[model samples]
Target: MKTSRLVIGILSIVLAVIVLFQSCAVGIGNALQANEEVSGSAGLMVAVILLVAGIIGIVTRNGGKGPFVAGAFYALGGILGLTNAGSYGDLILWSVVCFLFAAVFIIGNLIKKKS
Candidate 1:
């Protein structure tokens, strides 16, 4: 359980970095050009959400509720990634990572109870 929380804490920082990087004009422009589509307003929103969540996760790292909140945030981030079909590979990757973390937390607790 503690190990899971540690991994989540680390992942939160990584997620934050990814969001911040995406906020760069070059990244946004490239994303737009790739699709030759609408601007990156929607992506920006998701990035902001991820940033906020990551910050919260870091702040609440030692709290008992940290994992729960982090899990929710991760799931939301994964969903947001999935919404951008052009980034479907990233979407699947994030979703799997988030799910695996949640599963580890749950299973670890269950095993501890049985011991």
Candidate 2:
């Protein structure tokens, strides 16, 4: 398991948690307010998906191709986020970070394989 992959996995999980908490907060706030708009479900779904992917990456990190699989999931989530930009502009940043992490995992793995 490469250190970079491990670090990326941990960061991804952390980011997922942050997104989840924000989603929950928004949901609760909306529920408490009669006129409040509901706008957290999308964020929640994205966070959950990312969380699952991060966990998968961590669990399979020793399997050689696990990081790549995880990276793909992250990239996909990021792309999906683009469609929900109206409610969450942070999605762009999240997507960029995810892509960068994926790139690191892929390039690192390729180098390791070649060596």
Candidate 3:
């Protein structure tokens, strides 16, 4: 898998987690806040495309690393959405989530390569 793709895969997982958490928040205000964060249809479309790409990477690649790389691209697209269409406050939170997954992908790839 390519390095850029790996980074994106990690980001995808992170963004997904952030969205899930915000959506599940107990407060109505938080939920409403999440609603407002939605960007335009273009951003949404990008996220969907990234997701599809990630899935393809996972399924088509020979090694486990391929999926992670693809997933990073997916996350990068989500970050674009959260930063562009999503709320500023939510962007940081979401980016952090993306970062974490990116780290995982990086580590996983390194480990996989080492073996």
Predicted model with the maximum TM-score: 2
For candidate 3, the per-residue lDDT at 85 reads: 42
Off by over 4 Å in 2: 25-39
Error of 3 at 63 (Å): 1.6
Q: Which pairs clash in the backbone of model 1?
A: none
Candidate 2 per-residue C-alpha lDDT over 1-115 given as tens digits, one digit per residue, 9 for 90 to 100: 4565667677788999988887777667667774454356656766876787778777776658876788788777766665554445665666677677767767777777888
Report the lDDT tens digits of candidate 1 across residue range 16-62.
56644644553477575686532244345445655555565556555
Q: Which stretches of candidate 1 lie over 4 Å from their true place?
A: 23-27, 30-50, 55-63, 87-91, 105-115
Model 2 score (lDDT): 0.71
Q: Rank the candidates by TM-score, best first.
A: 2, 1, 3
- What local lDDT does model 3 show for residue 25? 43
lDDT of 1: 0.55
TM-score on alpha carbons, each prediction: 0.56, 0.75, 0.44
User: How does each model score on lDDT?
Assistant: 0.55, 0.71, 0.51
Local error of candidate 2 at residue 52 (angstroms): 1.8
